[model samples]
Target: MGNCCVAGASSDMATFKWSIDNFSSLLDKGEGWTNSRVFKIMGHAWHLKLNPMDRNSCDEECVSLRLQLSKTSVEPNTIVDASFRLIIYDQLYGKDSEHHVSHTFQTASTSSGKSCMIKLAALKNSSGFLVNNNCVFGVKFIKVVTTKAKTTSEKLFVKNASTLPEAKAAYTWCIADFFGMENPGYSPEFTAGGYKWSIRLDKEENHISLYLKKMINDLPEDSAVLVEFTLSIKNQEGGKHLKKKGLTQFSNNDPTWGWEKVVSMEDIQDSSNGYLIKTKCCIEAEVTTVGSSKMK
Candidate 1:
């Protein structure tokens, strides 16, 4: 910024008017002598430079004026996309000479940030400039905004997830506890896929049998929840564990879903195998659910 005055603003865009009472003496100060002010527009700080005398790219006989964005005010990309209109008021004729611009403005190294609408010559008795030693200018910025919408077409949203140790579901039944059973089977309810779920041992069957169950009422038509998981019997000796991969879904009539017979009782009861350890066994499920809903 050079020699200039900062004043109060009016209306939407910023406006500046300067009256050089000693116009002849100001121009004589030097060619590089500029009158500039640091102003804010569109939430960004900028400099409005008015060079009465000629500068590098400006002609000797013309008055050079332009706008520049301050370095600290720009975003990280070092580029600004904007649309603006600059105005130069010819005070002598009461008509404004305006230039409209809309483009992507780059950083300081790529551009000088100079937007000059006009270069008023020092013409005596001219209608284009210098009305009683007064000059006026204005700048207006146009803003852009964006919005998002939903579609009916199915969209897949995937995320990586894991279960915490504190939330793990495990249960062990002794021989006496198994014989004195009251319900259909032994089961422990847990939470997964943002809903209540459980893994159960099929009590009515004589052989090795289990199933996964989801507790939920009827959902909206075309809305479904599919859960894929691996249920494994934890091993103590670090040998390969007995694991079964299964997938289940939530529907109106049937919520309990899983394989009817996954393993045989003979293989599971073998003490040498890792499935039964110290008369205690454990079960773990790694679950991932994908829910789809029809968009209206």
Candidate 2:
């Protein structure tokens, strides 16, 4: 059982748009502002605020727009580094109005935008902006910095194996009380590549975390083992088995490597999924030691 895919970090831009119909009706509602349906960008919830009339006395002839981060979505004191563009589409003609902002949003600076987005007279002029009582607005997120920082240990694990060994071994562990099992359940030690190895499962709140651990003791300092492996949970009733693959180095200082969420507990608990049958389940690991070395 050596199976799982290599994992890494990624950062990509994201976008969102909002459209409103009956544009003229919003002005008659007497409400100073209205909000768009909530949407998400990289897991953070946000929404657009459209004010029919500008908030400032000097900009009364213009409409204002703002991008607001959802209070319930972000934690207190958390900071979000963001860059985005706000757009007001010209429905009839193709001339769109745009505004761009790059700022770190926090507790006090959760909203950002332009106070004078478009002139009320020009928007209602029956030209490009408002057509057939319809209007459109959009936001494109240029960046959203995540809080989690990748660790040096993960970098050491993703390196490609210098050489490949045809040798590989697979082992399976069966559990009697699947859900009732304590935090970590270890598989019997199995031999692979002249080293004893075992599978470890920690029952987390939402996932069954999996890890491949070396079970040997040695004297060599600065020693490391290059391994390629896959960890999986079998579907007892003939369903597709959940599996993941990984390639990493196992050293004296770091004897284990695997995913924090190999398979979710939700999938394991569903009876029809066949992951658990009569309170019993199976876990497997396929391991291969491509190479190993010791510091000179």
Best by lDDT: 2
Residue range 44-161, candidate 2, lDDT tens digits: 8888788876645664567788888888766665778888777787876677898887867677788885556787876787477776787777777778774542323322333354
Worst 10 residues of 2 by lDDT: 1-10
lDDT of 2: 0.75
Q: Give the per-residue lDDT digits (tens) of candidate 1, residues 1-296.
A: 11234333443544444345545566667566353456665556666555565433644355555556666665544556556555666765677766666655445432234444444353344655655654555555554122222236544333344432334343332333443445456455676656666677654444656666676665666555666767776664678877777655565556776666666666666777766665556666665675443424
For model 1 the local lDDT of residue 140 reads 55
- The runs of at least 3 residues in candidate 1 whose Cα sits more than 4 Å from the true structure, single-residue gaps closed, are 1-183, 203-206, 293-296
C-alpha lDDT of residue 48 in model 1: 55
Residue 102 local lDDT, model 1: 62
TM-score of every prediction relative to native = 0.38, 0.44
> Who wins the TM-score comparison?
2
